[model samples]
Target: MNAPPQEEATSAARVLVAEDDDAMRAMLVRTLRRAGYTVVEVEDGFELGDYVAMMRGHGGTLAPPDVIVSDVRMPGLNGLEALGRLRAQGVACPVLLLSAFADEETHAEALRLGARQLLDKPVDLDVLKAAVRDAVARG
Candidate 1:
């Protein structure tokens, strides 16, 4: 007998989050999911790179996330560095970079690296949702 047809995945936006803080990561995941987006949570930029590479290795069979939300500082590569690398690799997904210690230089660098927005830490969930929505619409 043939297997039953599977239902299509929801058309909700896909958002990948890279944050080292457990509590903050959880909050982001919860908020984004509650907002009806498909959220992928990672611990740091290194893991974020791994996820992106994995998707690329699938040769376009797997779709990359519509947006990436990453913290400025982490154990491994920082958000700016990761964003630069992703851009170098031709990943065109919009990025929303979050930082507790962001400065003017960092903001400039993020813009140079093609980040869609730089959000300071203790981010407001509503603002984040709006940014994500804007990123998706722009893309």
Candidate 2:
């Protein structure tokens, strides 16, 4: 037997969304919230970095979000840069990076930095939802 959709929604997996575009961020937040994820939105890489730092509890008591969905290109730190910093600090949470114009090198770096997935822009909502679910389940 499987849990009902309503019951699953109550699982409330936390998702951090980092995107510089206001419209895209809003859309991603709406999609994740509707899918029953507790979504946190950050406008740029700096905000993402700050949130991770604040959640990086002393003695490793605090845990990061279940997954992070970030845009690869942003002012200041960028998603790859943010992911690198987080990995350096031992944040092992799954990350899904989005890009409108990523080259092969960018893809290689994302993989090297331990991102779970690299999604292209104009992301399919269904794919995004599935990726988040997979990330949470894998964790």
Candidate 3:
């Protein structure tokens, strides 16, 4: 017997979320969970980098998440910088960034960093869900 498509996809799909705002992070976790994804939360970009490093093995087995959703403006090591570090380290998981204020340069830089999408703050839940699903499917 096989599981339904949605269940099979979401059950094994791990999503790492990096956001500094407590309320916003909670909302994101709740939303992703309701959408059936296995979610991991990190409060800032530094934590995000450390987790990614650990996932890259740290002398263990490689266990990268299916996708990463992050806030562009974190307290330290912002999302774009983290993404650059991940690329430098050869961790190529898809990334989606959230920003309350993204300018033209920011958008261009995000694209250069290979981010899948740059979603604005106060994001629509449905849009976020769809983007995550798309990123997972593409991976």
Candidate 4:
């Protein structure tokens, strides 16, 4: 047996959701919480930056979230740029990028910049859960 599936995460994993769409962001947060994760929400890149900085300034809240799930396209700054900035700021957390328009080029670039996973939109819940688990495991 491949060691039966894990029922719970090794750590208390929290997730940070960076999505500009109100409904989508809310849905992602709800879905994650239902899967037993703690979640925080950020609407855009600047807000995302502020959250990370706050966490860094103070040790961090809820372990700085084990993973970051961001929408690919957003106002002000997009997900890819956010990921790059986070990396520049020494964020080691795994980031999963989501896009309604996920094409080969996008995936290649995101992986190159260290994104842990990518999900094409409409967001399947089961797959999302599995991806979250794997990303948290990697962390």
Number of the predicted model whose TM-score against the real structure is largest: 3
Highest lDDT: which candidate? Answer: 3
Ten-residue stretch with the least lDDT total in model 4 = 3-12
lDDT of 1 by residue, 1-139 (tens): 7733321122367899999999999999998888777998999767876776677734544577888899989987889888877787788989999999999999999999999999998898999988987887776
Quote model 1's TM-score.
0.86
Which scores better on TM-score, 3 or 4?
Answer: 3
lDDT of 2: 0.87
Instruction: Give the alpha carbon lDDT tens digit for every residue of 27-114 in model 2.
Output: 9999999988898899998887677767764234446888999999998789998898888888888999999998899999999999
Give the TM-scores of the predictions, in the order they appear: 0.86, 0.88, 0.90, 0.84
Candidate 1 Cα misplacement greater than 4 A, ranges: 1-11, 57-62
Give the runs in model 4 whose Cα sits over 4 Å from its true position. 1-11, 57-63
Model 4 quality (TM-score): 0.84
Q: What is candidate 4's local distance difference test score? A: 0.84
Summing lDDT over every window of 10 consecutive residues in candidate 2, give the lowest-scoring window.
Answer: 54-63
- Candidate scoring better on TM-score of 1 and 4: 1
Off by over 4 Å in 3: 1-6, 57-62
Candidate 2: stretches off by over 4 Å: 1-10, 57-62
lDDT of candidate 1 vs native? 0.84
